[model samples]
Target chain A: MRVLGIDPGLTRCGVGVVDGAVGRTLTLVAAGAVRTPADEELPARLLGVEQGIEQWLDDYRPDAVAVERVFAQHNVRTVMGTAQAGAIAVVCAARRGLPVALHTPSEVKAAITGSGRADKAQVGAMVARILRLDGPPRPADAADAVALAICHLWRGSAQAHLARARQEFARRIETARQAHGL
Target chain B: MRVLGIDPGLTRCGVGVVDGAVGRTLTLVAAGAVRTPADEELPARLLGVEQGIEQWLDDYRPDAVAVERVFAQHNVRTVMGTAQAGAIAVVCAARRGLPVALHTPSEVKAAITGSGRADKAQVGAMVARILRLDGPPRPADAADAVALAICHLWRGSAQAHLARARQEFARRIETARQAHGL
Candidate 1:
């Protein structure tokens, strides 16, 4: 399945699409950033972000979307903008009826580099190697987005399968209980 | 002018519509909360917020919207959710082409109670008094939302006039400069 990962921000939002499936090699379909001017009003900037993500979703048509979940940070202003951007991305995907996943920074690092504590360089190196790129993706945000897509592709499939299994198991248990009339 | 104030949150998004202009008695047209269960997924919750805000906009048809500006907090998760909700409210207003304003907590408090550090009880009390209600609005979120609307109605008109004057002044200056060929 193809996955679109978004590293959401107001001034710059990173987007990367990856074509992959469970236990298969992943390929980079596209990588870029959506940017709004710092001087613009908040509402306009937000609308720009929403429109940008919607366009990307329409163009790439990824099976799923992965967004970097906002976490508490020392910089409240930055975190608020990131969270806003991330939320807009999720809304855009949901409006299109596409499945969305949120991956924390550590989670993306762990999935991409096998270490929750991996540094940015390590994650970038791993993403480059996995995607078979000669050099790391330009603009750290874009690389981070690629890493997010790769992480989602690698981890989300397993999680979805597990969820399905659990649901099926619950269904069978309910059916058995009904048959027994207990 | 009519103002729709939003107290943005993930679980309970408070909305209040107040009708009045500057130097006039404000009336609370509607006050309530748009609720989303905490048990729901993030995307679904975000969608709920979007839909809720859209419904309010459609129902009230307010001339302007005021959202509480989220600040960095000790609790990062709560702040993130609040910021996301606030952003969605802004987007909803912008989509409807209504002017949007963001009032900080301190600003709202000061506008309502004459003190930036006024307690919630003081703010709620003031809201009841301003709206000429016998008792405080139910749910602190709803009261706070009313305060947001009141604040915007009192402060936003002056700001809007100033903005328009500035725009007109700039236009005149450009015209004069062009005429002078300097």
Candidate 2:
């Protein structure tokens, strides 16, 4: 399965796609940043972000999307812009009927580095190791997005497996009940 | 001129429209709310908001859009949703080249009731008086949106007049300069 991850921001929205399945080595499909000019008015900049996200969706067509869930613990104005950018990403993915997931920054880092408190450099090193890259993706932001995609692939596949197992168990119960003619 | 006002929220987005030019009696064009199910996932709900805002824009075709400027002082989670919703409206307006303005709750209150700290009832009352309504729009949320529209009309018209005057002055200066061959 291919997954797209977004580390959303107004000035630079990081986007990365990885092709992978459960317990499989992931392949980097694409990685880049979508940008809006700082001088542009807020509404126009927001529109630009939306257009960029749509372009990425058209180009990659990932089976699922993972976005960094925004939190309110940071700089107020910047966080607001980040949240808005994240929303645009979410809306774009949902419009196309693609599954969307959100992972906190720490969650993504932990997923990649086995520690929630891992710093950027550590997380980047681990991500490089996981994907067998000579180094992490050029920019730190894109690397973060790539890590988020890896996190989703790992978690989503596990959940899908559990769901399928549950379905199979229910089917067996129904079949046994019918065989008993009760 | 017509103005569309949006009070952004994830659960119940209030929308209102008003029609009037500078120094004229304003008419209440419409007032209502757009809703998204609370149980829906964040991405799906955000898409619903975008669709709702698009529908309002299509129906009203207002010259401008006025959305409540979201602040980070409120409940953290709710504020994030509000900010996201506000961004969607701003993007929709910008996409259509409609002038988009953000009015803070306090600023809207001050414009309508002569005091920034005026209570909701006071703002609603002033809105009803200005628009000649028996009472504020049925829901409090819609009333807030109507007030925002009125606030924008008053402010936007003054700005437009100033801009027009400046342009006309520049034209006269150019004409005088040409006559003098300067």
Cα lDDT tens digits, model 2, B105-164, are 999998999899999999989999999999999578889999999999988887889999
lDDT of 1 by residue, A1-182 (tens): 99999999999999999999877889999998999999999999999999899899889999999999887864777888898999999999988889999999999999988899999999989999999998768778889999999989888778978999999999999999999996
Q: What TM-score against the true fold does each predicted structure earn?
A: 0.87, 0.91
DockQ for each numbered candidate: 0.63, 0.73
TM-score of 1: 0.87
Query: Model 1: which residue pairs collide?
Result: none
How do the candidates score on chain B by TM-score?
0.86, 0.88
Candidate 2 Cα deviation (angstroms), residue B159: 1.7
Candidate 2 wrongly placed segments (more than 4 Å): A164-182, B164-182
The TM-score obtained by chain A of candidate 1 when compared with the true chain A = 0.86
lDDT of 1: 0.91
**Deviation from native of the Cα of residue A48 in model 1, angstroms:** 0.8
DockQ of 2: 0.73
List the lowest-lDDT window of 10 residues for candidate 1 chain A: A69-78
Clashing pairs in 2: none
